[model samples]
Target: MGKYAHLNILLAEDDSSIRSAIKAMLFDLGIHKITEAADGEGALQNLIRTPQGYDLIICDWNMPNKNGLELLKDAKMRAPSTPFLMITGRADEESVMKALKSGVSGYLRKPFRMNQLESKIKVIADSWSEMA
Candidate 1:
């Protein structure tokens, strides 16, 4: 089995093309159980509705209705243990600090490679194992 095949991931990104690309990458990593949302609000709704909740959340920084940071904060409130990966084009110190403060598990900068995504996921998985 793939390293992340057991994970249920929620993806929130306003850009369809980028979402598709990330989905493909996730599949390549052997993660098939992905729930996608075109905006942050929809993603948050999904999080609320999923009784078992997701294993991880991958979200874009900018979106209509709610941004990724807002979603991250809200999701943390709902499912504090679930890991969150924020994808952002903005790499400024302020933006990074804000996301960290909101409790983002990791980050993927715009135009990331599959290996980079895998590395981030591996880190999350390792952390979970440690906790277990």
Candidate 2:
């Protein structure tokens, strides 16, 4: 099992296929406990409902109700300790810079491999461990 197997993750994506794909990858990585949201608004609601907060949050860049960046900003206020990963097709420098500035734990370009996802999650886990 991976180090993050016990993590409780929240995945927000408007596209069903993309969301399913990521969920598969998360499962392959041994992340079994996952909560899914169709948009940033739903993600924020989930965050609000959970008192302890999720272990990690993964979101897509574009969505109908709200965008990933918006959720990230709001989540920071409510669950600052939660690690957030933004997965998006928007690889432009400006978008990447904005995500970083908004306190994203990791930013992933679309078409990412399972290893890439695992690596990013590992980095977050390692950093959190160091802090603890």
Candidate 3:
């Protein structure tokens, strides 16, 4: 029914409304295995605690305590091959390129629909599986 059948997704978002919306959308797409963190700090803590619990991580670029880029760096350093995606309102070319070079699996701009989310998830899932 969905492009990605089953996956454990880590979502790091500071906004409560967006977090709820994202979870609802993902659930609607038949993805229920999700972990939420309010900020990058909490996201990192979660990752460190459960390193292999997730198949992918969707992180916000800007947050109160550690930002997404910082979190991405930390995650890659810790897990090395874990795919970390950056979903943010910042859509500038410089930021996007920086994220790619920093080992971000993918980047999506804000105000995106559930379809966009699904597509990115599928890409990450497919690539990760291939690599594995």
Instruction: Point out where model 3 deviates above 4 Å.
Output: 1-5
The all-Cα superposition gives candidate 1 an RMSD in Å to the true structure of 0.7
Clashing pairs in 2: none
Model 3, 82-128: lDDT tens per residue? 88879999988999999999999999999899989888888988899
Candidate 2 regions exceeding 4 Å error are none
- What is the TM-score of candidate 1? 0.97
| Candidate structures ordered by lDDT, highest first | 1, 2, 3
lDDT of 3: 0.89
Encode model 1's per-residue lDDT on 3-92: one tens digit a residue: 789999999999999999999999999999999999999999999899899989999999999999889989999999999999999999
Error of 3 at 117 (Å): 0.6
Best by TM-score: 1
Estimate the overall C-alpha local distance difference test score of candidate 2.
Answer: 0.92
Better of 1 and 3 by lDDT: 1
Root-mean-square deviation of every model: 0.7, 0.9, 1.3
